[model samples]
Target: MTTPAAPARRVPEAVHRRRWVILGVLMLSLLIVVLDNSILNVAIKTISTPAPTGLGATQSELEWAINSYTLVFAGLLFTAGLLGDRLGRKKVLIGGLAVFGIGSALAAFSGSPAELIGFRAVMGLGAAFVMPATLAVLMNVFERDEQPKAIGIWTGGVGLAIAIGPITGGVLLDHFWWGSVFLVNVPIVLFAVALMLWLVPDSRDPKPGRIDPLGVVLSVTGLVLLVYGIIKGGRLADFTDATVLSTVGAGLAVLAVFVVVEKRSDHPSIDVTYFRSKVFSAAIAAVALVFFALMGVTFFAVFYIQSVRGYSPLDTGLLLLPLAATQMIFAPRARLLVDRFGHRATTTGGLVMLAATLAAFALLDADTPIWFLEVVFFLMGTGMAHVMTPVSVVIMQALPREKAGSASALSNTFRQVGGALGIAVLGSVLSAAYRTDIEDELGLLPPGARHAAGESIEATLAAADRLGARGEALVGEAGDAFLHAMHVTALWGAGVAVAGAIVTALFLPGRTPASEGGDRNQELAPAAER
Candidate 1:
């Protein structure tokens, strides 16, 4: 008569209380990191305009201001996770906050576009450190039963950040100089740093292995080159140009080699086998595409609301509230829909809604009712709520407990990569279409003015303002051309959403009642051992 095994003991009550407090701090840190990713959106116009009011930056330079941060953040995420594992996560987190604060302060005082871009990259470095450390610390503190709930809260913070960032930035831009956008981060960073030091516990892998130096080099180099090539191809170079072709080809080749190298490494930074699971692959793809659609729409829509519709920065941010508000409201409830309809149904349905919304946006013009855009924005945000949160839960379930930090970083990296690509490809299409439509209208202007106007919508608007009554007529023409370009770009975004929907439906595994419990392990296992 063998006795039944004793039930596992629960974490101590004191530890449990501490863990919840720590989680709150983690959420605060995550909120700041995620908010910085998008806070620049509503301020783009102010930052790039001619001096006295702005830096007088070029269009490509403006793109770099945003892309440089995302690119570096995405590129270093995995490597930074490994470093956090090897070093103390709390140490890394505190250090990251300091770096971010310093970068923000420096950015506020930047005199040139180059200085701002460089400081932005520094902030990205700090973000890379902060992001993985927060998740890793959360995983360490929470019990298995608690982790999923914790992750839900953490994911909800991202939605909240998205909801708040633009409006906050818009308000600041209304009253303050463009540099105030970066400056706002300084105080928040200080608060997070203080709270984190007091409440967060230090954690790291006791048996952390050697850092994969080659993997670090390859991932950073490959992603930077690929993104640079795509942006250049869209804005500055033809697809067939030697610089574009060679850079893109080189990036692809290096990434392929990186995959091969990782597969063979005894202690790889990213385990290639994770992608073998359909849940992981499909979830990653769906989330990435969701971000792709979101960023692509924002890339053009912000300009439309500002330049064409003549809304102020504050009003443009308010116009976007429907999208952010719907997303924030729906995010916490996403899991219920997943359980009711299953992952495949919920995710695919959301993608279809996104596609439909994008298609509707393609029909919009300068005079389309504001109410119509509000409806579209709400639907788009709702669809994203379904796609992002559910897929994140699926991914969290798919990863082993020990790999939490790396897996979280991986998910965010793909999302950032997708966003960067969307901007590049869609921005390129908009540029090409706008150039064709605007050139005919610009024939009446002097060559210098024509060249400047052809470069960007902002430039065209500025040129129009200089020409008095003729400029007003030119503004009308420019708006028309911009609307046409926007329509075509919206169609392209719709196609991407459709593809995501089809992929989610066909490739993601169907959910069953038992399968959900069976998918996750009951105990932690080190990824290196696996």
Candidate 2:
């Protein structure tokens, strides 16, 4: 005879009552972090312009400004997640918000590109704590049955940030200095901190593991080295350079050592064994690959819309509305698709759709209709919404509720690292391609200026402006070269998305009776229990 059915999992009365409110607070926290990145997308062109009006940042320096934040954020996330689980999520969240606000202020007043990059790293440090803590807190407040829906709404917050950030940045850039985009975070942070203290409850792991300082150091060092190598390769347009090869090799070596150390440690920063579960591994991989493709494409798209197409910052922000709008519309409803079609089918379909849209970029030229881009952005958002929500549910639910911080950290770590690599690698590809096509035309410029002019479309235009009427042919050639580079980069992004679709289809779980009940806790369960 079977034993009596186990009692249903219990969520505390206070938590149950205020779960939605807590989610709202968490979303507010998430909004500021995500909003900063989206706003920066529209401002990339402006940041590259000459001084007084802009920073006159080179393409590589601009990449560093972006990558510096991403690298630090990705590297510190696992440690921050552990801290949230051990020290208390509410404390970590409040502290993170404060730090982020401070960083934003510092970033706003940065005097140069170098200062901006440093300040952005400070922002990333705070964000590392903020992102995982938000998800970990949500997992605690909501019960298993309601998690997917809660997570869907939570993911939709990203859509909302995407919607608001560019438009807000556009208005500020139109009326005020570039610093206004960053300064705007201060008031919002103040409001979120007050709401969080009043409405959110503190939570932590009942049995927390020791902090692995060595692992943290290794991870950060490796990522920084790796990303630096990639960016350097792009700057020189030569991956075969000794510096690039040596740094990249060393980074891989350090990361390999990190994995080995984590495997042997008693209180590891990351439980390497959790990756044995094919479903868990696949979901994490999918997150990484998708972000890699998307972030890289986005880095180029901003320049395309502004520099190549001659659109104002305000127009670029308005044009991007369809991407964010579609995500807001589809993200909350994505769980319905998962329920009907299961994770594998839904995610696979989404990846295919994403790949198709990336490939569609190859069809775009300087003269491509704006409406075509709107359609592509709409479909791209729809695809992203479907992929993100279902996989998030899978990854979060795979481990016990108490380990939510680790789970969330693992998911976000891969996503951020993927985006960082995408921007570096794909940005490099675009740079290399454009440099090759534009180098010949640079003969019109002075000897020293030719090298600078070939760096990017913006640089070429800046050089053209200095040359007056004689630069007209160079201007036309620069636009054509950039389009070719963009097309090449788009295809590379599409190929990466297709690889993600394959991994999702092959390894992510199909529909199962216990899918919503957290399924089998095969790999992540404690050793004693296992």
User: Which lDDT tens digits does candidate 1 get at residues 1-530?
Assistant: 99999656344456567897888899889888877756788878887688878887766677777777777777777777778878888998899888888888888888999998899889888888888889888887887766666776777777788778888888988898988988999999999999987878777777665678898789878877887787677664266778988999999899999899999998776777777766678888998888887887888888889888889888888888888888778877887777677778989999999999988878788889999999999999899888887787677656565666777777888887788778777777777678778888887678876765776788787777777787778888888998998999899999999999998998765555745544433311222134
Q: How many residue pairs clash per model? A: 0, 0
lDDT of 1 at 404: 64
In model 2, the runs with Cα more than 4 Å from the true position are 1-9, 513-530
1-62 in candidate 2: lDDT tens per residue? 99999666567887789899999999999999999999999998998999888899999999
Candidate 1 local Cα displacement, residue 162, angstroms: 1.2
Clashing pairs in 2: none
Best by lDDT: 2
Clash count in backbone of candidate 2: 0
